[model samples]
Target: MRFKNKVVVVTGASQNTGVAIAKRFLEEGSKVLINSNVKDDLQEVYKELSVHYKDSVMQYVADISDEAQVSAMFKALDEAYGRIDILVNNACHQGIGPTFEEIPTSFFWNVLQVNLQGTFMMSQQAVSRMLKQENKGVIVNMGSNVSKRAIHNRAAYVASKSGIDGLTKAMAIDLGPKGIRVNTVAPGYIFTNRWEVLDEAIKERRRTNIPLGVEAYGKDIADAVLFLASDEAKVINGSRLVVDGGCSAQHMPIDVDF
Candidate 1:
């Protein structure tokens, strides 16, 4: 119960990594605020979590990219929880296309507006609210291995994640003296909703990219965030912890023969 009595806000908690992060916090004795824009998914997850956590878990549905909605959500948090100790910016958007040039302009902008700008908007509100409260706060932004390397076709995603990492560093330096900590956890090849319906052949091929023979799970990413938000990482700030199962360590694929 490292986070016992702490109030946490996890953006994009409708499903996948968001749900995992929220669940982990609840298990660690934290009061969690789950946020997501998807109505049906949000309601479903809220009901499921409400069963286990009851009054400890709260749901706030708002698109992080929308300033008015973000403000309203924070206001609601203030009214309900009174204090926020940790914030996990786990929401993201990635537009699919074969090449950058072929991608639509609207798609490219949408990716940045949500993935990059949304991160900034949420952090701003969290920091402001934290300053007024005791214990300050901690923020963990979700980054990706695609940002480290120029992964193919996901130019917008790679760019936004890379930008978020940069934002993490900037926030850390500015907020450290203010008693707030900021960091990023970059995960590679985490198996989520997108891969749920993928063919076995595709899954096997995806595994080939990861040197560890298996991809990361949503829990792996959540565990990392929990550590960063805990007191154990008090001195740790402005760090980008890569939880990719050594995927980022590979420079070239090596042939294995029995």
Candidate 2:
């Protein structure tokens, strides 16, 4: 119950990594507001989670890319909870593959709008609200190891994630004065539903690089997010915690000597 009494807002919690993180937080005793743009099934996901947390989670359907919706979501949070404690910017459109020239210019803009701009907007709003309160808060940006190591056919995602590193540092510096800690949790090739869409050969190659001999799970990333949100990481700001099973530490194309 490290996050007991904490009010948390987790974007993109309909499924995948975001859902895992929100569930973990709920297990740790935090009141969570989970959001997803798809309104139809969002409540279903919330209700499913309710079986585990039982009324500790609320569902908010808002497109994080839209400033109005974003504002309304946070405002809703304030109205319901009266204050903010921990914010996890986990909403993102995984714009995989497609080079700049191959995809439409709008595609690039849309990716930036969701991944980079949305993250910036959420952090700013959360910080503004947190500043009004006497207690400090934590903002954990969901980043990818691809920010440091780029893979083939993921130009937009790579660029957005790399930008997250800069955004994380800048936000940390600007908000540190207000006692708002900002950091990123960069996961490398976690086995999500999205992973199934990747090429088999690529997955095999990634597995070979992982020192742990297996792919990292979404729960692993969730645990890391929980730690960063906890008092244990009270001093960990502007840092990128890479939870990749040491994937980033290995050099690709190493000669396998028999």
Q: Best-fitting candidate, measured by TM-score? A: 1
Q: For this target, which candidate reaches the highest lDDT against the unseen true structure?
A: 1
Residue 147 CA displacement from its true place in model 1, Å: 0.7
Candidate 1 C-alpha lDDT tens digits along 95-134: 5675987888888888998988999999999999899887
**lDDT, residue 63, candidate 2:** 92
List TM-scores for all candidates, in order.
Answer: 0.96, 0.94
Candidate 1 clashes between residue pairs 3 or more apart in a chain or in different chains: none
Task: Report the error of model 1 at residue 66, Å.
Answer: 0.7
lDDT of every predicted structure (CA atoms): 0.91, 0.88
List, in order, the clash count of every candidate structure.
0, 1
Q: Residue by residue across 1-258, what tens digits does model 2's lDDT show?
A: 788889999998888888889889988899999998988768888889888787688889999899999999988998889888999999988997687679878888889899999999988889888998889799999999999889877788888999999999999998888799999999987898877889999888778778776887878989999888888988998999999888788776343522
Error of 1 at 5 (Å): 1.2
Pull out the clashing pairs in model 2: 97-153
